[model samples]
Target: MAKKSGNAFDFGLFKRLVGYTNPYRFTFYFVGLAAVLLSIFAVARPYLLQQAIDTGFVPKNENLILEYVVLMLVVLFLEVIFQFLFIYFANWLGQEVIRDIRVKLFDHMMLFKKQYYDQSAVGRLVTRAVSDIETIASIFSEGLFMIFSDLLKMIVILGFMTYKSWQLTLIVLAILPLILYATRVFQKKMKTAFEEVRTQVSNLNSFVQERITGMKIVQLFTREETEYTNFRSINEKHKKGWVKTVWYNSIFFPIAEMSSSVTIGLIVWFGGLRAAEGDVITLGVVIAFIELSQMLFRPLRQIADKFNTLQMGMVAASRVFAILDTDARVENKGTIQLKNISGAIDFDEVRFSYLEGEEVLKGVSFSVNSGDTVAIVGATGAGKSTIINLLNRFYEIDSGTILIDDKDINTIDLKSLRSHIAVVLQDVFLFADTILNNITLNNPDITEQQVTEAAKEIKIHDFIMSLPDGYHYNVKERGAMLSSGQRQLISFLRAYVTNPEILVLDEATSSIDSHSEQLIQDATDKITEGRTSMVIAHRLATIKNADKIIVMDRGLIVEQGTHTELLEIDNGYYKNLYDVQFSTVTE
Candidate 1:
């Protein structure tokens, strides 16, 4: 059983959410004023009817009756106008606030540390940004002003009832305790039910999103029946959550309705008897109190339901605020901007861990001098990718320091640090856009001529020209339209076009055809000519000519030297790896 957010209303949460309305304060106040006017005008109807009956019927004055009817019509017209204003501007205010909140939330998420995402679900974040924020919008359009209007209308009706006849007012007020208790019970029940519904919604979102994203794997492994069963189970729980809310509504609404009906009946019976006995309760008063009883009790019934909506909004608001409150981000406090850097990188006994007490890089030390190409080779999980992630400032080091050209990388501006280094990853991802946009990432500074020149330098210009629309070709999602090797070509061109001082190629040539491999090989050779390059590869043949090689095992560097020099050592780690891999290639 999951915990439900209760206390129905949270004043602190309310105030914080209301702060978003500061920019649209005029609309906020206007809607509030409209609610008040609508409430006053709502009470005007019963009074006008009471006057029309007592003055126009008992006194037989047709002209006054006509005047009261005309006044009623005018008030109705005003109520309609204000109702429209209340609804329109309230929704407008909601949209504006959500727009600002969504943007701010997304901006905050964009800066979250990589480690934060490692443990978070993408679908859950999507819900917060999309549906959950929409729930907060209901706070304005349906919850806040509607509840205020209903409560105000009930108050004004109560005042009129007491003024007309205190006896009838007491009869109506007698049902108050019963209805209030029912509302409380209904509220608690509904709160838990709604929490389950929201939880199931998030679960469904997460399940569906991941399944759809990995549909290929599902089909590859013939998991259609199994996945369908899993989906049905989740869907059933989602249905059960909603049914519980419906069941609660079924019980509560009729009880509320019966309470209202009994109060109205008591008003008619008591006021009629007193009027017949020639007391102060006149026929007009009886009729008016009946209408007033409805106006009062119906809102009491509705206020319960509207408050539920308000509670859900607050629950959603709390979720949204939780994300906004997330402070997991790489702190960028360095004021020193990096420029004209020599691309000299030194890792001074750097220690790091993705999880506490589980060190991935333990006191790893290495150095890459300016204008040199270095290759790092190790089996999987040797902290190879961790090094690149740290260099880009995606994650903070657990201990030790990394220096760039004698200056600490932590002291260099994060944005400027990444700007001067272009990392070409092994898994190339391209957007669903034109080949040109994918290469330049819509950067206005990188023109077609520059891209063409860069493409020609890497010898991929002929390949781009061969495509159906040339550089204007749409690659579809994740470059699904292009082959793996072709996508790598685009990635190389993207990296080279930036012309960064340092290049980190993370096994970019793996898992491709022989022709594509040679083409990428040629592009790789061309790009690393004058740049400080760090090449991570499992294919030892590819990096045999590298100026230096760093061989690592389990989180520690075991060997460092040129390929020939390391191979010359008897029983060395690099020598063993070289012998095994070169034999497999020969076989």
Candidate 2:
């Protein structure tokens, strides 16, 4: 919730934005030169007309009049050339700067900790990356440099008017304060309106994106009408936000038009009075003053609109910079690079909580030897999955230490540490791509032949080949083209291809059918061979052959032993859970 600053032009924001243009400084310098040439050409047209009327046409000299007219056409042609150069270079510079900023913004987002994403809205971030950056682009294409050129044109026109007839110029300057004050007030109101428009746009994007992504849930629950009603409310706010801007435009432009008309009338009336007194003010000077007044006032009116563009760009820059300034990135200060760890993991009194004052793992400790298979069984919310999350350093522990191969986990390079570990969750995610690409994840080093070899070893090669396109089959979004069991097999093949030292199966078979479960079980046996494996399963039957069983209750390991040893314990948590599941299977 960033508040709007009272200052119209934030120089600090402007300077920072200008820094992005440094990479294209030569193009911008050329644009500046074009602006200066454009101003000079713009002022020459009215002055050429004055020369034709005063020295050529009134004196009835056809040759002189033709010369003046020819010169004016040449100036007009040059003006058009410079105008084209100004527009082309300005937009090119803007696009290049925004492309660099977008890359930097996305790279920065990649470094943020998972906690930052957990608290932020996807739609709001999308708005910042796409829409807000687009608005900043307008600052260059339509705003800042255009306003600069307009201001220069006005200054040149003013000097010419003063040189022609100082008395008439003084009279026209009299109405300047009123127009300036009105423009200032209009800009302030427009700034507030633009801020509202941006806010509403972000909200609308968030609402629509969430609803669309979760459309399956909405359809399952028959929430169509309720969701539609909610969307209409948000859409209405978006509409009103834009309508306010149009309303301000409606009010301001009429005032500008009337002021321009008044200035022209005064010139005609006063100039006529001076001329009737016998040859004091000529018709050409008076007519040139009319054109000059338009040149001056037109930019003044346009400056207000351009100022709005500048203001919106500043606001967008401030929001984008706020994201870049965040310090929520995961700290990767470890210098140790153990690319091939020995797979021994030890959790020494580890404690963690996703939320403050609500601990999920309270001083839990465990040890898994190299190449050993350990299974953790627990009721839902009993901290079984939290162990895997902490093992991979997804979330830092609040208290105690996690060690890998006798070295503190925090002391290992993050990439090297995770490289040796692979995780296959119950809800496996697949990108919208070919089976081969998804399996290898487009890693050029991991060849298509390597992925096929891994799939064949995991016994999923035949199943994948059964598809119409085999390895080239498009999975579509989230692998929707495959069944739950098929997706699990793909996940298994993905992990197996990585050849990680430590493999984690977090309820990987919890959501599949008996057939799919059997396929996953077979794949799991082959993938976990000679690797340190930790399996979190609710189904008691899945881990019956695990070398060691750890039973957890309320975030504490209440029992730990082999299946037979645990079943021998009187009323042990493991025995109780095993009996209930076993009885259900028997029935």
lDDT of each: 0.89, 0.88
Instruction: Give one digit per residue, the lDDT tens place, for model 1 in 202-256.
Output: 8999999999989999999999999999999999999999999889899999998
Q: How well does model 2 score by local distance difference test?
A: 0.88
True-vs-predicted CA distance for residue 505, candidate 1, Å = 0.9
Clashes of 1: 0
Task: For model 2, give the RMSD to the true fold.
Answer: 1.9
Q: Please, what is the TM-score per model? A: 0.96, 0.96
Candidate 2 contains a number of clashing pairs equal to 0
Q: Using alpha carbons, what is the TM-score of model 2?
A: 0.96
State the local distance difference test value for candidate 1.
0.89
- Candidate 2: misplaced stretches above 4 Å? 1-3, 276-280
